[model samples]
Target: MTNETKIPNTRWWRILPATVLVYIVANIDRANISFAMAGGMMEDLGLDAVAIGMAIGIFFWGYLLLQVPGGHLAERKSAKHFIAAMIVIWGGCATICGFISTSFEFNVVRFILGIAEGGIFPAILVIISHWFPPAERARANSIFLLSFPLSAIISGPISGWLIATWGWREMFIIEGVASIALIFLWMPLIADRPSKAKWLSAEERNWIESELAAEAAAKKAAAATNKSATKTSYRELVFDINLWKMVAVYFLICCAFYVLSFWLPTIIKDILKADIGMVGWLSALPNIAAALGIVFFGRMADKSQNRRKYCIIPYVCVGLCIIASVFTASYSGWLSFAFLCLCGFFWLSGHPVLWTIVAETFQPEVAGGARGAINALGNLSGFFAPMLLGYMIQNYSRDAGMYIFAVLVFLAAVIVWSMPKNAETKAAVEKTREHVAATTNAHA
Candidate 1:
């Protein structure tokens, strides 16, 4: 079918299922390390918390380096093929992680894993941007993000059990196999954009086109008029104030999130003096809270149509919770459990809206690249959060670690608040729509 003939009525119903499955595997692979660490990988490897954190953080090093290129590739390639290829490679690496005995080997596998997985989130974001209109974007993002929490929920208990019964390596192999299975399932379902979807209804296509066109037009006009111009260059994103602000936001969020991912299982185990089975179940609690948090924040952003405040509020709340938890909770089982749930809820609440803003901020042609660049840059904190927190906990105290996280979370909120709103973003979006239309008309 011709591009024009195929543009309308994409069956989102079909695409969403496959997208969710891919997300689940991707997230589980990304996060299963937490389970490994808690399950005894650290002692077995004879590594300190700092060493483990550094190893885990190194994944971000590779992940960040490849983001822009990955984005560029996503723009040009078939999203399904790209995702499928990456999954098999990374998932295989993850499975192999189970067999490796040395820290160096672990680092190597993780670095490779990072490179392989770097493209998934940014590419998915770009795909979602094309598939859904601005009004529907948050909801779409929410649904897609559900995979993150769901993966955590599955990974936590299952991984813990695997670690207890079979060993951490076994957990990796099982999850890896699941990822490989998903690639085949995903192959037939994912297309690059709604325009390419074959099963969409004629009316649905027209409706989406109209919504996208209108939104894009407003974005363009705003961009054309904005005078406080921050000229975006491939190189200058590193130096750009707006980019830095975004980086700060990312860093802060990672502080909270990485802590939960890396340390929550340990915290639950330590606080309750729980055995492996109990620790596994307890690890799932925070993820459950996070899942609810993502859904709530996503729907709120969708309802409010305001990304900035929506993103900021939850982050700030997370910071407050971190501070409060450090003081009130005696590390008793019940208090720790309650605090974990609260921290998880608030800490994760910002992501859906933040991701939505990231999707809306860039031009479609380069959206993937920009998203990847920002995400890559922003992700630098992922490495540090684990390292820094682990160090603090080992040397200072858990309270000290929580305090540091509170500070970082608060810092992220400040940066988000400081960022000059691109009132022009909406206009730029609108202009792009008009440009696409004019080009289409000219061709006709």
Candidate 2:
């Protein structure tokens, strides 16, 4: 766009493999508790549905509160440093959780894990914005995001194997040790930008800088024309109609997501009466489906440049699939599995849209804070989703819990659709195109 011609290289893809791999590890550690519960975790800990819900939901308690501050910090510091540090802290806490024999100790360790885990998403969002331009951001995000599904898919079987073979304690210990190893590996590999990385070619550096320079020029132009552009406070993002709408949409999605994370394995092992191995495998299926969905939809989002449609469509599909899942779970095994896969697929597709939209809405300077604010507020749903599902499951039936989930998903879909479509994004895109044309003409 800046008329800086540079050959595209494949070096960006290399960082992606390691980045996405650690991302997968992070999610796996976050999600492994669901699988652990299927083992003797619930029985030994003497946890009821409510207590279990609290345990899972508590991670978000600290996570929600720290998001904005973490975002601000991420903007100031290197994301690699933030991510590496948090990994160690959370991994250490997770390992200690394995040693906790009492419910109080378990809660304490989980709370610590929550605090350590809080900054990851916001930091990653900030990194994505810095690393890739709007044109490539969705695809880049999708690649890193591939870890979500991979984590989900792998967590069940891996945790199950560890739990069944070695014991659940060992699963935490092994995951923690692996996380520490990943931190060191990630250090030498990840850089804040291509310019900072010695391995990146000059062409690659120019390409990244050119993409960003165009964006900066556009923002400078906008700031000259609009008072809000020049004087807008980060806090104002909270009140902006579009930002709030996005937050509400994400809140609903988080509600559905955390519910599944907390309760899915338990439902399989307890309600469906599945064996431990079966529970692990079944739990992994939805995650695998979700992983596939992220890749497919993420690429599509980039190709089409239609973030809103991608965001809305998948959510509607997720709600429908959840409803179908509720009914199918009462039917044959194959039907149940099919519905879970469908539900997981659509549920997973919404994430790239969520983060990408935040990146698009704000300027790069405040993007981290914006992401943090959205995530912090939206994650409040994390507090309620699991606890509500737990209550429903305890008081009613698993069927009722699924019905409740379906309703929440539908509500989330509505919120996503209600977000005001900024014609500004399209305008910015057109301007970017025109600027590129002018620059090319001048260079020629």
State each model's CA lDDT, in order: 0.75, 0.76
Please list the residue runs of candidate 1 whose C-alpha ends up more than 4 Å from where it truly belongs after superposition: 1-12, 224-240, 421-444
Clashes of each: 19, 0
* Shift of residue 160 alpha carbon in model 1, Å: 1.7
Per-model TM values vs. the true structure: 0.89, 0.93
lDDT of 2 by residue, 1-444 (tens): 343224564545666777788878877777788877778888998998888878887777778767887888887788878888988888788778778887788777887777888888888777667777777788778888888778877888888888889998899889877877787788887887777788887767776776677665555565543323342468666566776777788888888887776677876665467888888888888888888888888888877877878888888888788788777765665677688778888887878977777766667667788788788888878778888887887888777877777777788778777764534564665597577768877987
lDDT of 1 at 260: 72
